[model samples]
Target: MACAGLVGCASVAVTDDAITQRTAFALGVDRKDLTISNRVDDGTTSRYQVKTRAGRQYNCFVGGSISVLGRTVSEAICTEVGRDGATRPAVAPANCNALLKSAGKC
Candidate 1:
């Protein structure tokens, strides 16, 4: 099946620093305010569960390189995890939404 509606299916490695920073940016929060965990890697992508200081949780999927000599995370998506474990598109700030518009994900 196609990976549409899925996150982190790109053919690139996911970096901790890059993913964390991008996740925070997408959530409109500081890196220090978020706690990322439960990373599961599958060659091309990495999935992580992130919890913010305010108890908001998310499932962030990341892939692609974030280096000067490579493309910087052309595909990074984070979805909000509901209390019952269901996931939905994360609601990002206007600026962050605009930034992620090109990728068609949040």
Candidate 2:
């Protein structure tokens, strides 16, 4: 019994003034760079970036800490869906059905 719907994701920050936003993994990593991914100004410290193939991206965010599994795995959400259609706007990574489901953005 999986709920078919878009997983609504939000942003999380490590500090109060820190402008760290989380983009879904599906649309974030684009081998080159994340276009639609949120970023801070020049003075601000925004080094959150990941390298992955297009279409495989989904429900991932820029965490302030390093990913333990080498790949930045976003287990920060709790949900499920039947399909995946969301993207992070960066590398246009391939979408994952399971990620979209768990991320609540399908």
Candidate 3:
């Protein structure tokens, strides 16, 4: 798993309250109408952005991840505050620019 070392990731799970608060402070998003959760796979070097609908209480994910043996390569949880006073949790894309625009480390 030497390749695993080349790629690394992390994640965090927060309550709806904490997510809302942090998202507001960081992204300036206000409105506890959404939930976000993401996982990162280092194997294929891909990230998945799991986000819930503002009107719904289910998480819908976007993005791609590396796969091996029909399984995920790496898994991580990213916690941060985004705009609108809501916490946005998404797999940080492998792309530098994409990752930078994902969310804050809050």
Candidate 4:
């Protein structure tokens, strides 16, 4: 009863297209040149691993809230992955320094 009320009745689904688009835009690449290596969906949030044709890899996360009326609001974020498995805010060949600076992640 009370627990049910606390749970959301609506489910949010994150599409591959959305993730790919967001990743491509963040890396300043074309969608055709990017490949999605993995995707994980945890209810209202989704995480993806995207790789570029140039061998760059990124980790992308997109989360959103869904209203009872079925309205969804989503936000996406991406970070580059180094060879050591560390995450960074800038990607190579994409002028990401400026992007990271603007996003306050640099």
Candidate 5:
């Protein structure tokens, strides 16, 4: 049972890493420059608070399932952080929205 719990944790870590990478790419920033400050996981879905090197922050959501074959696939939704640290998806610029749309995110 302990081993099974460890495996589950490992899988969640992998999923978080994948989502972080995808978010960095969508934001056109280096992966290393982004910091994940907070995360919440609810079964197959997860949400994150990512801060960029420039101090800009975002709220990111990722959801998907792992297949029996151990393959993981997920979709991500991200929005800029407002002055009060709230997620402001409507404030996203056209170019950013286009990029997110192309990546099947947002």
Candidate 6:
């Protein structure tokens, strides 16, 4: 019973549309240009692989939250994946710091 309560309190179902929109904004591309796949969910956070029409691939992390008041998406961040499998922030250097700071990652 206690575990169930905890799970309910901590879980939020992040919608595909939300993820697509967030990824598009982060990658500076149109939502229609992106294809999302390989979703892995853990608690309130979900990770997905995004492939763009231009053959670029990205890893996107989306966090969601549910409270007594309502449900909301906490954050979304996408990073480009190199051919060598390295992940780098997709945002330009000029905006990278700001983006990371806003995401509470820096």
| Candidate number achieving the greatest lDDT relative to the actual structure | 6
Q: All candidates' lDDT scores?
A: 0.71, 0.30, 0.36, 0.68, 0.66, 0.74
As a whole number from 0 to 100, the lDDT of residue 45 in candidate 1 is: 69
For candidate 6, the per-residue lDDT at 25 reads 79
Better of 2 and 5 by TM-score: 5
Against the hidden true structure, what lDDT does model 3 obtain? 0.36
Model 1 agreement with the true structure over 1-106: per-residue lDDT tens digits: 2343333334444667777888888888898999999888664567889999999988888766434454556345788888887765686555456656766554
RMSD of 1: 7.2
| Clash count (model 3, backbone only) | 23
Q: Residue 21's C-alpha lDDT in candidate 6?
A: 80
Instruction: Please report how far candidate 5 places residue 25 from its true position, in Å.
Output: 1.6
Native-to-model Cα distance after best TM-score fit, residue 23 in candidate 4, in Å: 1.6
lDDT of 5 by residue, 1-106 (tens): 1224223432353466787787887677898998986777766567788898999888877765544456464545678878985556623455556766676444
Candidate 6 residue-wise lDDT, 1-106, digit = tens: 1224323322345778888887887788998999999988777788889999999998888887565656677556877888898766676667657657786433
Candidate 4 Cα lDDT to native? 0.68
TM-score of each model, paired residue for residue:
0.65, 0.22, 0.23, 0.67, 0.66, 0.75
Looking at model 4, which ten-residue stretch has the lowest summed lDDT?
1-10
Worst 10 residues of 2 by lDDT: 73-82
lDDT of 5 at 46: 71
lDDT of 2 by residue, 6-99 (tens): 3211222233222222333333332244323333312212333332344232232233322333323232221221135534332213554676
- 1 versus 3: better lDDT goes to: 1
